[model samples]
Target: MAREPLHLLKTVYGYDAFRGRQAEIIDHAIAGGNAFVLMPTGGGKSLCYQIPALCRPGMGLVVSPLIALMADQVAALRQAGVKAAALNSSLAPQERTAIWQAMEKGALDLLYVAPETLLRPAFLERLRAMRLSLIAIDEAHCLSQWGHDFRPEYRRLDCLADLFPDTPRMALTATADAPTRAEIVSHLKIGVENSFIAGFDRPNIRYAIAEKDAPRRQMLAFLEAHKGDSGIIYCLSKRKTEETAAFLNERGYTALAYHAGLDKAVRDANQTRFQREDGLVMVATIAFGMGIDKPDVRFVLHLDLPGSIEAYYQETGRAGRDGLPADALMLYGYEDIALRQRFIDESDAPEQRKRMERQKLDALLGLTETGQCRRQVLLNYFGESHAPCGNCDNCATPPEMFDGSIAAQKALSCIYRTGERFGQAYIVSVLLGAEDERISRFGHDRLSTYGIGKEHDARTWRSILRQLVAHGLVNVDLAGHGGLSISERGRDFLREKPALMLRIPARTGGRPAKAAPHEVARGIAPADRALFEALREKRLSIARAQNLPPYVIFHDKTLVEMAVVRPRDRRALEAISGVGHSKLERYGAAFLDVIARHSP
Candidate 1:
């Protein structure tokens, strides 16, 4: 327990100093205090617990949420010269026996287990037999029943405190609001005062949200700039996941689909390829990112709106984990927002839960239509204060703001006039005097509101109504064919005629995303792009030879730094950021040869 964490970070993980609060967290956990940590992805959360686990006396037990995450983490740790293994259902008979023997002999430094495996009574009894050092619960937000990634097994982990009262336990998650944090504290039985909230702003990830117009075309346009990079595209449904993946693959992009509907082996393989290869895009539902640890994911795209800000943060946080510039683009629309609310309304979840879900959706929708900086609004949700990040889409080009008070009044009047029983499409058509079957049958065209909104087109009106829903002036009633219902706020607005400003998306060109900034900007000057690719090829070859993922051999960031520094000799190569003593000793000469072959 008295070992120095900075020493472990240097020799073991190949870093010099702790990035942010990692040193503080490590110190806290090493001193045998029950610690709760909330850190964003790519913020070096693993080291916070890993260092303490190594410094402490007994074996460190990490309760991870996903098998892929466990495997990836264990592999990365082993590559960094630490003894780590995962005990999940995926292990073979001999593998499990080997871990058990290792545990009995006090040979493991860090061992990861999934909730399902860790919660079994037999497993708990077996763990009781061991001299436990620390219990680290990664993705501890799963303990919150209200959060998106809820797990009942996580609720059972509170027993660990009762089971081993003296063992220092740590709960860590990238996403958790105050309520969820309270739940984690209550369920994990950890001290609320001991909790640490790391900064939620991921400045490395540029946030962009676009209205879903010609989604595949828009998605294609966005993907054009991201060719030859790894990314994730999230769809709302399984069918969409497959179709999107196929469509992208048909267009010559390396893409794969993953969902619970797919066979487990297929899901596993798709995940493995995404984890191990470059330039592969995973088209998946929410099922994909619970525990993914790929460090070089260049972007994370959402084809549909996420249900909550917590989910959006966690999913997008998956990108740029290596402290490099990455992108988060989302394409959403009125229907997408309405559809999410419809789900929440239709669910049998408790009334209080539904209210919370609706509020969460409203918050996310506000981000989409907000005129303020996207980064500012998002960080505000996590209780972190940040200036407008100059890099986000809003900061790059602010949305046009017009006096939407009249438009808001007209839209709310329309919802009120329609008996609040028809969906937005029908309402828009009624406004446009479409004379469609629904409009004609409703005989609501006779109303003064009808055809009065003809000043704006149907699409514009739809956008207005969607923003109205986002503004909480309108609600979606799923029981009535996704009808737009007027809220009390809407009624009050109608009565008061308040001045409202709505963000209007630019009609056309604003700014085109640069194509492959990582390669273009960082790859310029001393780092000959050709040499970097050659170095990447060499690293890939070594990874394949060792049967390890390419990043395990050396992350993309490390290779880029090498090309930039152009370390001519073995000693200089050892000074690179990710090149630890063991890594430098093991693969230093090969990388040095590659660097030397293409030295400028």
Candidate 2:
């Protein structure tokens, strides 16, 4: 087989070429090899399977966890003229029978089924009778018990590959750390030589961690800055999701709440609206959705802490899938840690499971408290080394560190004076020498350290408390009565390193400038703006007709470039960033016609 043929197929699909390790994985799969692909979201994982499905004979078997993902992917493939169909509980009996018939008749090139459907003995027997070109396990991390979203059904999928030893198999996921990766391989019985790990850096997403202050007020500021843009606000609880969505809706924004509590129809409808419409926000919890294929989410706001960094990364990965600039904002506080610990303690998981969950939780908390570049920390979590991105909040506004040895001593003294039985709010009150009923009842008013730190406000005292927790100088006893207690690190800090550097929280207040108009000519004359829109519309229409992603047809940046250069012919279009000789040959006439019609 000639490699040039794949390149020609690439051009026909309007993509420049395979991205990252896509071509390598595709080749391996096409040659009847097994692969375990650990690629992040927006890392071109789909191409690894999609290209092989297109190049090889027989239908590709895609086992997905979500029905919505199946539908979205099938729709995208169909739009590109690929004969794809999904068989899941959502399909009618007749429709399901027809799809299976189509599969047996070899009319469908790709078939997506839920894991439950794949586990059926009859279904497996039918699949055995068909010619399966390859098996692609999407969201492969779910196979591991250590994974945050462990599904029992995923573990059974290994039998599918077992029954079809001659077929190639590929497993892909957006988030998996070292242990999770190892567990996936062992659970699926995959060989190490077959795994392909793509670099897990999403450079386009700017990461920021905001100290939990008035969370609602902080969220408002963030939304105000990035108004009229699509985003997702993830809350830890369903009530919070409803409240946040309602609050945003009341504030004159298009916001919808989605959780498992709602009817399935409503959830599907809201998700569809969010993906198809512009500037719509979906406030959801972990129960709502995953593997959403929306490409233009501009931001992901975490109103509460996620249980693990993996969950956080995957949720935030939803933003900027189009490889454009976006934001990841996390609002965290001490209470979040307690909430997670409490939830973990109540779960029916085994001791090992609980231990792994705690470790994951600690990793998430470490990201919140670290003064290092947020992006670097996130990348490092996924086994990638990177210097400071110089784009996150920590890199942009470096914190001012102060020697808080004496302050740490004072705060520790207060906690001791109160018998280590108080939460953060009460501790702050005592540190500030506020006379409250709780303090009076506890006789904390007579302590020597009382009123010692009266000069600092409640905010300053709260910052000290947070730093104490972050440094492991103090620990919140989740199993006990939920109060702060001094740790051994605290004693060491007091005795050995008297001078500790503590970071001051970034101040929050300001109205960001409104986004410039979507029109290309922000400050240009109306005639030029009209011409730009005309050109863009023409490009989009051509993209649709050719069954390609809009950006592959001509990136938004390329359209902006065309607007500036007023490219008049094939030669000029070929000089554009994304348009090469093949693109110019195929698409030049249509774009040039638009420019000719619109040019003054």
List pairs with backbone clashes in candidate 2: none
Model 1 Cα lDDT, one tens digit per residue, 123-157: 99999999988999999999888989888888888
The TM-score, computed over Cα atoms with residue i paired to residue i, of candidate 2 is 0.87
- Give the C-alpha lDDT of model 1: 0.85
> How many Å off is the CA of 337 in candidate 1?
1.5
Q: For residues 430-506, could you state the per-residue lDDT of candidate 2 as single tens digits?
A: 88888798778878888887788886678878888887886668878767666998888787876776777776655
TM-score of every candidate: 0.94, 0.87
Show the lowest summed lDDT stretch of 10 residues, model 1: 509-518
RMSD of each: 2.5, 4.2
The list of candidate 1 runs beyond 4 A from truth reads 415-426, 429-447, 475-485, 509-523
Model 1 earns a TM-score of 0.94
